[model samples]
Target: MSGPVSSTPAALTAPPKSPKVAPAPPAPAAPTLRDSNNNNNNNNNNNNNVVIDGILSKLLGARQTADGSCARVQLTNRELLEVTRRAQQVFSEESMLLRVSPPLRVFGDLHGQFRDFLLLLDQTGLPPGTRFLFLGDYVDRGEQSLEVVTLLFALKVRFPTSVFLLRGNHEVQPVNRRYGFFQEVTSRYNLEIYARFGSAFAYMPVAAVVGEKIFCVHGGISPRLHNLDQIRDIPRPARVPKQGLLTDLLWADPHPAAENFTDNLERGGGVPGAFRFRPHMSRPPALYKRPRIFCRSTTTHYLLGA
Candidate 1:
């Protein structure tokens, strides 16, 4: 349900390095879904079918009510380019990646906790030369989503590489509309800036590889994702589009069982149509197929092998 949390293993320890501005490579082309033997089963076949049917049906119906609304509202390439340029200007290249000595700090689900976030920064001693990779969910569900975004934007501006921002489910469109982000933006800034920032989120990378060993993301792994490349091939939206691809990522819960190639059912005990996981667990024991492990500090449930 939450992002992956790991201990700072001694073997994986490395010092932070100064940020380097490598030339941004051309964005990878979006992957096309072809009929593959791996997904020949009724369940796997239904996944793509459900996505297409839902998107097409929604677009077809929305076309009648609004003329070119989707086209007009969608983020343009020019807008995205401008945001990136501004971001580059605000944050120095070196700020993007910091070389912390050993024992990295991992934080989860800030959910716009501005004061608490500040406390975390103070406690962790983040800014000067430490690397902090935030696993999404930065906004929403808190009173100060705007402050949280502003602070993060400032941090990114100050230390881009040191503070890595990954895309979270809440960062997408429909969820923002329902949650506090859109309203917070409109109230704090103007609708124009709100829309602009929304567009910028599309450019945010979905996953980050820390030290080439640990993988970090806002949400858990999906059935659609097998190898890391499969995740990379997913289209990055400039703005949250209808049918909620980004939303699915933010909300999708990961289970250890789903990671097993042998396990057919999803973490939520469903047929895996459109990758929906069940919302509730009948009992805590029935929830996970494996043993539950607890951290000495927090009692929240997490997969042992995960």
Candidate 2:
């Protein structure tokens, strides 16, 4: 028929076509060192989160003390150290002054009153739902100083943005060591744990501004303070100085009798002279030039849940 169908059959006549095969997808690129490191970091973070969750569960579920006393929650020094270290890392990134937007619930002087603190949270709601700015004095006074501090660190680590902690007078070693916190820590854990807590405390923000209108601090204004930059300039891992802007911020009390500032005779009359202000600081041209600022503070003398 067509030259006897050519010498070769039609199937074999098509120019010896190569077999149709899909090129294998390029071999997946090998993971780089960066990818491996990232994966490890993620895994470590996940493990830390699990540990924190366990600690929180233990704290929230523990029986409330009837006598209003601290019943230790059986956490080891290692666990405490881990929590403190993480808290330090979080605090180190924040400035001495924190600027926050409103719809915030400001609390002052928890004073180691874990039960009362819990009740307050229950009423106001927790993080993400309602933001909180704690105005220091977290430890000492109440019998549950350890519980209060540990819970706060756990919360700070878990909700770094939503919940903020400011440095209170009790947060300093010189103050806390004389108060009940040192006794509680030493009795339950050890001096090293107490020291670690001190280290973490040094990193706490000293003050906060909310809605850009209100200035909040554990104590009142300091005479040494001229502008907000002074607060911003204060370095981290800072121990409360003997006498200066930092000390005044943490220890100043309100005294209507005094005109500007007077020695805080109540606390041995060293530094942190008490502050007194009416509606505005009109005398200081520098302060008057700045935007209107309202101050809210829990005086050093006043202890919440006392």
Candidate 3:
């Protein structure tokens, strides 16, 4: 079913220009702990300092004011470090807490439903010390794609380590253009950030292995993918082609059959292979009585019964 895709002019408006904010004061050097000789501690202390400096660089690099009226502060390095440290502490403490309660409230197809998305947060509770994996499809087909993306981006900034976002079929450019995400991004953030976020989406993981058992993805299984390792070996480009290795995986459908199959139907037919499919069972009574015969061909098995 189609639904309204919200677009707010304000969400796309450029930030107002204001006076440059002063940079924060430098941090005090970490104190060195050394033995009586005090010879080796200097190197260790320097290494630690270098690591801290690297983190500070990332924080400072990401800092930039959007405009004058915007009170929202992009994270600074100091803030990022603090957030990371806090997240680490929380993880250490609550590593086992979620196991006893729930499997982390998995969600699917949040196509930029910003309002409902927030409601979901209120309903499911934020991913403070726990885990939540969104099965992709975060953008497109909704008005609040910008808000949705920015909100998730902000969450990534805040929680960093705890929040997980995977790439869905809609994440690809062509599909996104046909869907609503491309328009939502261009309308809201202009093409620049849209491109940036698109690039970000490319790097996003395609699937997630949850709790070591269930495999979650936006789409289904493909004949090309016989096992999970094959999928992992596939080189994911920064963006997917219209149809190819990545596209097939993100768009393929799974079947219920025990083995792969082939039929008179073309290569891309709905029931191309012997894989399990829920739709095949919905045929006419006659077909059910003389159901398709199962045969193993050179390349794949076939379901045959005219």
Candidate 4:
């Protein structure tokens, strides 16, 4: 995928620093929207659209300044909950492994840098007009995880077919709790809302196949997965487990020097089986099939020589 994504440590590891300066002009105002819901799911579509629009405007219209940082104004608890709920409904219908065609923009870990996320959209054009496949890690590490994720969910709801989100290791609660997302959410809202975000994350697809040749994931390949069918067979609405296929898919790394699958000491050694590997040795032929595997981890585990 794009000629062996660079595995160099700084590639996806650092968030772009916001330039220190005055705020940029505000984005154009969107229509004021009413927050409403109904029992009939179909009837709620209009309300969902309105809610998402408001959320987007609030997030997209964030005050930008130099220092590469932007201001953050938290969304109401109800609005945040609605975004997660609608996003879950869309994600619930997708396969654990999405099959996507090309002419797409595949993004790596954003790590909650909302301004950079905005700049990417600004440069690449937004959804519907331009298709995007996000390799997760939408939250944690940076200051605006809430803004980043909320904007993502709003865009997903606004254009479900055009935006694809894969689950990353950080999307799960355990890692985020230890990182920064949990504190960010609980500091503003409460435990229940944070839990709802986790529930939605549970439904996120973990991997994708672009143009039927490029395999994209947040982490690296799994020995347990021999074929696309096995990946599809993975059940959703589930947490990223401590071990097994899903765990490997979300946390595994690649090592050019590895002789075989080995413990990933970088990720707290030996908890999940076979976390690092040499491509030719560890990958199943059925899954490899000359496909370029795209992996973006904070640790920079891009598998290039497969």
> Model 1 segments beyond 4 Å from truth?
1-85, 88-103, 238-249, 255-306
The full ranking of all candidates by TM-score, starting with the best, is 4, 2, 1, 3
TM-score of 2: 0.78
What is the C-alpha local distance difference test score of each model? 0.44, 0.67, 0.45, 0.74
Stronger candidate by lDDT (2 vs 4): 4
Residues 1-306 of candidate 2: C-alpha lDDT, one tens digit per residue: 001112322111112223323321111111111111123346676677666655666665444344543345788777798899988888998888899877777787888887777656545545544567888988988888888888889877766776789988889887778778999899988999999999999999998877765677887677788888898888877866667888877877766566556777677424444444422334333234433454445632221110
**TM-scores, all models, native as reference:** 0.53, 0.78, 0.52, 0.83
lDDT over C-alpha atoms for residue 264 of model 4: 81
Candidate 2: residue pairs that collide: none
lDDT of 3: 0.45
RMSD value for candidate 4? 7.2
Weakest lDDT window of 10 consecutive positions for candidate 3: 5-14
Instruction: State the lDDT of candidate 3 residue by residue for 1-306, as single tens digits.
Output: 012222211111112323445432111122121122124336654454344333323321223334311122233344334333432332333221122122455667778665466445534444443446666778888765655655565454334444656677777776787778778656544665556566666666665555543445555434454445554555534456544445544554434553332221332323233233332333222224332432111113234323
What shift in Å separates residue 239 of candidate 2 from its native position after superposition? 1.9
Question: Top model by lDDT, which number?
Answer: 4
Q: Ten consecutive residues with minimal summed lDDT in candidate 2?
A: 25-34
For model 4, residues 1-306, the per-residue Cα lDDT tens digits are 222222222201222334536534334345343222223346568756767787877776677755647878678888988999999998998899888887778888998888888776655655455678899899989988988888888878776777889998889888899889999999988998899999999999988888866778888776677777877888877766668888888888777777667778777523455388775463465466646555455544344455
Per-residue C-alpha lDDT of model 1 across residues 87-189, encoded as one tens digit per residue = 4343322222122222355466777665566545534443324556666777788866755655465445434445566666666666776678888767655
Candidate 4 local Cα displacement, residue 300, angstroms: 7.6
Higher-lDDT candidate among 1 and 4?
4
